[model samples]
Target: MTDQLSQLKQLTTVVADTGDFASIAQYQPEDATTNPSLILKTIEQSQYQHLATEALQFAASTLANGTQAQRIALAADKLAVLIGHQLMQQVPGYVSTEVDARLSFNSMATIEKAHQLLDLYQQQGADTSRVLIKVAATWEGIQAARVLEQQGIRCNLTLIFSFAQARASAEASAFLISPFVGRILDWYKKQQPDADFSGAQDPGVQFVRKVYQYFKQHRYPTIVMGASFRNTEEIRQLAGCDRLTISPNLLAELADSHQPVIRQLHADVPFIEVPGALTEAEFRWQMLEDPMATDKLLEGIRQFAADQQKLEELLKAV
Candidate 1:
């Protein structure tokens, strides 16, 4: 019998979710994702100080003729692009570099910022084809992604929690969608004390599975990546998903044990019945109906926005 990792790979593509180089070498995931939070966390660690120093040096060199804010923005872009380039050396798949979360609500601003990030990567002789520019899954964000996709810039719609957001992204023909599994579980655990966790039934797991089945069933070409995991069980439950971007800690956990991992998602499986495109009014209504999704989406955006501000400040201090 095949090991669980191999067995799981038979059904889904596993991507690492971190900025730590050491973790990427250990699990050897096909791709990697980084955001302000992950980058901030990595900067605090003793092992990742070199990454920060390199970013600072690059920022200092390039921004020698620019303003402080411009230098900071340039630094953030350089750091993120540098990290992407380094990770690509290890993972054959694409690396997702997120846009400033502060621009999530502004469609035009997000588009311009994305182009700027892509431009920096291209300057480094990196293939833009291997890059997935990440954006929040707000309506504005999706609109920006649609524009970017038309310009041959693939996008990873992040901070997604609701089915409405997923549907909008698919309708826009986004390159990929990242539905946060752990965050969904966090919401459910707070509200539903009697939640069951048997046989692919957790709320977070169920959310990703539903989106996956919908996309597969309807032949929506958008890729669904289950991200932000809380436990190996959630990861195991989503084994057959289109892709699962896991944290290094969980990847290490998965690699250490020899357990039976079953296939939960597959292209050949029949998809469950799902509804069609929701209207703006319907989307708003559904979001209102589901308090958890509403609250979580807002909270996630706020957190990312705060992190973006802090990153800007860090660049200033550098």
Candidate 2:
């Protein structure tokens, strides 16, 4: 019998959700994703320090007249692309590089940063076509992604927690959307400490199931990638999703087990019709109504931004 990891791959595209090249090689996922947190975690290793050094060199040469803050920001961007470029070599499919989280609400700045990252990837001889610029699924972020998509750059809308965010992302023609699984479960667990949840009953698992059904029923082109899983059960429950981005620990767990992996989600599931494309007001209202979604989205952004700042500080010290 094949390991659960191998079995799951036959049903869904597996994606490694880390910046470490060694893990990417070992898991052999078709695609991989990285954000400020992952990148910060990876570069702390001594072997990966050269990427930081190289990023600083690139920044200094390119932004000689810019301020120290400007140089640090450029270095941060370069470092992310450098890590992504390396990851691209390990994966056969897309590698997602994120826009600065602080710019999540600035549509124009987000677009500009996306262009900058692509340009850096091009200069590094990385295949631009295989790269997906990751943007937060804020209304501004979605609008920026809409523009970038029109200009032929694909985007991965990250930190999605609501159906409204999903609908807006699809309506914007985003290439992909990552709805976090573990984080949703985290919020629910905090709310009900005494309650135990697992398998299909997991709130995070249920959330992705709904989004997958909506996308499939509506025949939206945007891909639904379940991410930030807490355990293999969350991953197992979301089997047959468009894609699943998993951390190395969970991937290792799946590889060790020969448990039967069943196809739990399918495109034929019953769907709830959301009226139409979400307006900014409607999007904001929906976010307001779902406290879990609202809390998680804000926390995700702040955590990413904090890690991004840490990455910059790391680069400055190098």
Residue range 1-318, candidate 1, lDDT tens digits: 655566667678989899888888987888899998888777667776676677777777977888777777778778788888888888999999999887888999999998888888888889889999999988888989999999999999998889989999998889999999989888888887787755477788999988888899888889999999888899888888889998988877777777888777677656556556667687778778978888988898889778877777766664
Residue 239 Cα positional deviation in candidate 2, in Å, after optimal superposition: 0.8
Off by over 4 Å in 2: 269-274
The true-structure Cα RMSD of candidate 1 reads 2.2
Local accuracy by lDDT, each model: 0.84, 0.94
- In each prediction, how many residue pairs overlap at the backbone (N, C-alpha, C within less than 3 A)? 1, 0
Q: Write the per-residue lDDT of candidate 2 for residues 10-37, one digit (tens) a residue.
A: 9999999999999988999999999999
TM-score of each: 0.92, 0.97
Screening candidate 2 with a backbone cut-off below 3 angstroms (N, C-alpha, C), the clashing residue pairs are none
* Runs with alpha carbons beyond 4 Å of true place in candidate 1: 1-3, 269-277
